[model samples]
Target: MSKIKLRPKSPVRLVATLTFLLISLQIASIIGQYLAHQFSIHRAIDVVERRISLDSAFLDVGNETLNTPANRYAIERYLERLEKVLEEKNLPVVVSEIQGVRTKSDLTEFPRLHRTTFENAEQTISISINSRNPLNEVGISWLSIILALLISPLFAFTSKKRRAQSAREEIVLPPKPRLVINLQEKTISNGIDDKVVTLQNKPLCFYTALVKYCIDNPNESLPPHKDVPHELMALANKCFGRLIELGHTKRKRPDFNANLDKTLSEIRAALDDVFTGYIDEKETYYPPRAQGEGSRSKQHSYALPSIKEDDIEIIGN
Candidate 1:
């Protein structure tokens, strides 16, 4: 004989199982309701029957019959039955017992008179209706089952749709790119000349250098600069724009800005030192004066090396 293996139920199946349980519980509740209805109907009928039996007994005995042992015994039994009915119905019931002399006035009170005569007093029993709803001869358990059958499938379908949508989103969407900007260093490379420059170890490619060069010489362009890529241009613009925005802010932070400006000035000085061939020597070179003095003459030109089509390169204009 071969053994059959059962597979574990997945999440959807588990949800379906729970739905089935709910439907079963609802069916049970419906069955319970019908049973309760039948009980109520039976109890009401019993109460009516007891009241009729007591009336018949009173009719058989004479109205003038005083509180004799037999009469009292019958009355006591009636009271006990009425009490039991009251308890079962969860309410009060009133019944009237009149024992008097056979008078025309007394006879007017009850149309179907039984044992009325010249008597002493009246005994009263109040019959209060517990409820007006009629007996439920048929059970509606099948309705609950039908509703569950209809709604459970719909609920499962909706859940399945939601789960599928979530799965698709997980598969379709791309993960975000991680940005790690190390501002400590930067390097810029001129693709045309194969020259490279670094600032705090951050790369400053042709586009970045061009942006800086533009900032210094707004009205001029780099003579032998290579074409800038779109991505590089955007990055360079973002970097330069942040500094420009900081500089334009109205907030006063003199020392902070001063230090930042000094660092930038040093970077420019280093670039100038490199261009002037003074990067190798530890000493600063001071060009000879033209034997003249002016407010604007303090500025000195340091010519950048020029590249020609031939192998021999020219320096200074």
Candidate 2:
């Protein structure tokens, strides 16, 4: 405790720290000088602005009028208006003096018109505020803010109405149309004719009205079916020319004709079932094979395939 001693700081660290502190101080001084220079320039600009005003004095417009309190009041008002009018111009307008207090007269190159007047005071002045009125298509400039004020209400009313009417409305639905369908015949154009081929100046559907008519009058000496590949092919060709006629795109079942003939035979047999007189009853009971007194046997039913008129033979019967 009695021999406690303090160690000296390193010279290298002390020198480095001093160098950093000096550099920081120099940088701060430079920044301060730059800020001062900016401040001085801003002050100079302010002084220059103080020298001139943005508004202008009124000018004379009329020559035959007199100077009165009313006329003076008009001049002051004209100056205020001129100040407003000057705002729109690139080169600012500074009114000098209002002269010729009388009727509003024309002035050159300025929105306001004025003339020297004589009626009351030793010096009388008159001015005409620009009537930036829309005369036909031409417009006259004005210095007054009354128009701007008046239009604000119209804008506010429109805005409020627009806001109020912005709500969305639900759509109303209508009744559905009636629909009809047929299997044997097609009444609609979309049911057939995949290639949209027309026949007889109309689109040909396999089950369409024209096909039904053909079937109704098959013996009417029209196109035949055997030469054509399919049943619907002849119908399609009848509707549109052969060049544009759409064909039947179908996978004909294996031995389709044989199967169809077999089906037709079965149907013909069924129809011929009513022609039982063709068979002899005594021979139909059974053949002479395995004859017995108490014998049982199946009935031998027979029928013939249907024959068209062309296939029929003119016999003695």
Candidate 3:
């Protein structure tokens, strides 16, 4: 007769747990976003750096083929192509005439607005392309995706452990007691005879005797004693008497057998009334009263054992 105590619910614990998880997720997401942005910026810078070198090489070709109709045509074609690319990427470019010759790498920063200069005998041409905005051009949604991947497994593990704890708390079953029964003697020490009744040549009288002793001896510790109604006691007595009569009968009396069967049914129903509230499938046994039978001076106490098929004992010829 143990009881399960439920823990009190706490709003603070719930709020705290949610806050901690949200903070962890937010921190992870922020770090991922920062990395993604930097990666995109660096990638755009690399592309622009390569373009700067290519522009320098193209301008050197123009300087080599100066003052020719083919040189003018090639320069115009190169300008048209480079301008078209810059326009498509939403970048700005400027062309200017300059005095000194310069290499593209040494002219200005490659990833920013920078100038690449080419010179010949009389004139110099300088082209400066403004770097494209990395933030506007690149998508970094994979930051969010990466953060989700890292947090999913952690959330799953926490949820699983919480569910397991809840399940354990919800269905706490009591421990079972060590139970045994003796059936060698025909008479008992308390002056009650232990009758031997047989059903289909197999003895079943032990059931009645054991039940009677449990019902009559309320003060005994072997079978737990509890409160039972008069109707249940009357039914139990009738069942016990019928079993004894069936044992002593001389002929094959179907009428007696039928009466005994009916009485047994009534007895089970009575026991159900007395013990149904105390027994369950997991912990199937009668609970002992805190106080013994004699402790209740005025009230009538009776032993109500939660009976199972194996509770009945048989050990004689």
Q: Which digits, one per residue and each the tens of the lDDT, describe model 3 over residues 1-317?
A: 64444343355755555556556666666666667655654554455446644554445334334552225545555556654664586433322212232222221322445455544453455545444343343444455555655654443323445556799999968633222222233221111222222232112232344355555554444321233334434543454455445464344322222343333334334334433333453123233233544433344322344555444333332
> Over the stretch 53-121, how does candidate 2's per-residue lDDT look in tens digits?
221222333334453233555665765555554444422223434443322333333443222223332
Cα deviation of 50, candidate 2, in Å:
1.1
Give per-residue CA lDDT, model 1, range 206-311, as digits (tens): 2233333343443442221223334435555455444345443333222211232233344454444333433432121111122244212334221112211231
Model 2's number of clashes is: 28
Once superposed on the true structure, which residue ranges of model 3 sit more than 4 Å away at CA?
1-9, 60-317
Q: What is the C-alpha lDDT of each candidate?
A: 0.39, 0.32, 0.41
* Alpha-carbon runs more than 4 Å astray in model 1: 1-75, 80-140, 153-164, 177-198, 201-317
Question: What number of clashing residue pairs does each candidate have, in the order they appear?
Answer: 28, 28, 0
What's the TM-score of every candidate structure?
Answer: 0.26, 0.17, 0.26
Q: Can you rank all candidates by lDDT, best first?
A: 3, 1, 2
Query: Where's the lowest-lDDT run of ten residues in candidate 1?
Result: 308-317
- Residue 146 local lDDT, model 3: 58
Measured by TM-score, the strongest candidate is 1
User: Considering summed lDDT, which 10 consecutive residues are worst modelled in model 3?
Assistant: 187-196
